[model samples]
Target: MPVRRADAPEPERRDLDVRGTSVRMLSGGAGPDLVFLHGAGGAGRWLEFQARLAERFHVRCPSHPGHGGSPAAEWIEHISDLAFHYLDLLDTLRLERVHLVGASFGGWIAAEVAVMASHRLASLTLIDPVGIKVDGWIYPFLFGMDIPEIVQTVFHNPMAALALAPPDQSVDTLAFQYRQGAAIARVSWNPYLYDPLLRRRLARITTPTLLCWGAHDRLAPVEPCAQAWVKEVPGARLRVFADSGHVPHVEEPAAVAAAIAEFCGGIR
Candidate 1:
């Protein structure tokens, strides 16, 4: 298969049964465990950026329930529910301490996880997170936008976004994308993406945090959002990607990965 040709994308695929619920994961690399919570789009797939992270740490990226391979549950409806779900995942893995990285929607989840319980967490990194409501932040209505619009909103370079597009987006693929969108809406629609209480709860987080933002991000103004993250989370540091959009990991993987390595390397 092309996935195994040349620079092989060799990730171990595993489905972990966490008490009756099944969690699908792509795991690779061999250092300290690094749990990655992905954005809405790239679920159940390993990308080049993941492989780069795996070069230094054992990277575990899970498909959020109902998004990709993971099954949806009746009890899961909001971001708080997702946060507890990941807590259970950590307990199931018996990982006492692991670094956590969340991108976009996943960054929101990571933040909740840190506040809910940071006993087992070593460090936290949030990449363009959007769970906190800041006035005049200007987040585009993610669900209202079409695929092209979504892509345009997320990438600084149009060609880079176009290059990643799948040639044949079959019906099943499109259906899956909508399902993910529905899942996102279920959690984000009520208060319009940002949790009303999350900003206040930020002070509860004790984990060392790195807030990463893209300078050219169209979804929201980078300065206010990043500044808010830094001010709210105690001792949190901010890093800005000068020429990327919402998804820096997709638009500028090497630079993002390098920043991550430097931040995570100091631990232990």
Candidate 2:
């Protein structure tokens, strides 16, 4: 488990038995149910961005199988597996008309869930997602990149990424990151991050979709990736953070949270 400082707003941590898997989850706040899905790197951490969103809505952040403290599910061979896991999670919680938010890879998962069952969600927010392939637009190949290169590519402000880094890159930290990488590789390595059929399935998402992207995102550029998503999902809108990169929520938490809150507010 990643350690949180004493000063941060703390959320209740518990394990839920869903789909024969014990899922580690963090839940807090007092309003509508809002589930946040983390990207590849950060998982099971109570970050400031989540705290901000929790102020107005009940926020539930779950560690996907094989990430953070959650044990790996050997059956999860594809991204769709993770998507089904989350749908089961929502079913287990008995959450209705919930707001779903996902960043980067998690965004892909959220999109998948919406495609399968839009009735469970009130709104969907995707941040710098990389699941759909756009013709004539190519992002960087992330499999072989070093940490420094990845950090540079993910954040517009280098200092912002550095500030989020753990104080010491100890063996435990390295192992934690390695586990996350391996989990990503298991599902994404062969396909190289995009699903061939996902683009065609976007029309199935009846839930209102919000696409949030960093104007400076090097991993998934705004031109075709973000714009392409808007065109695919019916009535989808785009919100771009001029000063951020791939992960706008991390770089601009307050603004990102505000945008999400506003979007969810309208749906209610």
Candidate 3:
């Protein structure tokens, strides 16, 4: 399991209905609003990294509908559905603007939100995100791999990957994993794993964006697919973590946090 610092307290969890979708949110600290979005298949559990981030920012880590404790929304048709729902969430919370930080599928949603409502965003940080469809780029099917295989193939550090999996894979846990995978597929299946037209829409995003990628990412390699985001988004900057993979925040939290802190400093 990922080791928690001795100084870190357990996070507080709660639920709220955002636009008819029940959202489970893990909250901590108090400062500027920082919204953390996890990848597909993961839950707010990964928000442990956000606790450290909360030291300087009020962190709100919401379980995307259909993942973890959050109930699946019937109306969730596409990635854009998630983007709009989060907008509703901000409105419900009465936050004028927030620093958006997302990973994997959450990163894709952040990009969509920046394009659709950049004015409501203070800044954006994406870590090994996937959403745009690029020819010849094959996104590893995370749902298809067993936990061990996933850990070996998707994560650069085996220890981090092992920490991410449940201690014991009971029948109940396996069943829940399948159910979560199915729900994720429902919203992200048609074009295999990405929106076919999302790449063309990147230019409209006006938020100061930071794209961070793990150099060893096999799921979404940095060279072509992941690095493409830096070129597409106007004024977007890229940072590559040489020793990390898809989930850099978990693999190298300190480095990820430092990069984010620097990027967010300009906003405030």
> How much lDDT does each candidate structure score?
0.82, 0.86, 0.82
Instruction: lDDT winner between 2 and 3, please give it.
Output: 2
Q: Candidate 3 lDDT (Cα, whole model)?
A: 0.82
TM-score for each candidate, following the candidate numbering: 0.93, 0.94, 0.94
The root-mean-square deviation over C-alpha atoms between each candidate and the true structure, in angstroms, is 2.5, 2.6, 1.7
lDDT of 1 by residue, 81-100 (tens): 88988988998888888899
Worst 10 residues of 1 by lDDT: 1-10
lDDT of 2: 0.86
Off by over 4 Å in 2: 1-8, 163-167
Candidate of highest lDDT? 2
List candidate 3 stretches off by more than 4 Å. Answer: 46-48
Candidate 2 per-residue lDDT over residues 1-268, each given as its tens digit: 1123356578999899997988899988889889999887657767768888888899999998878746778888899999999999998998867899999999999999999999999899999998988887766877788878988888898767754575477897777667777888898887778778899999999998899999999999998789899899999999999989998888888788899999988987
Please give the lDDT score at residue 103 for candidate 1.
93
**Model 1 clash pairs?**
none
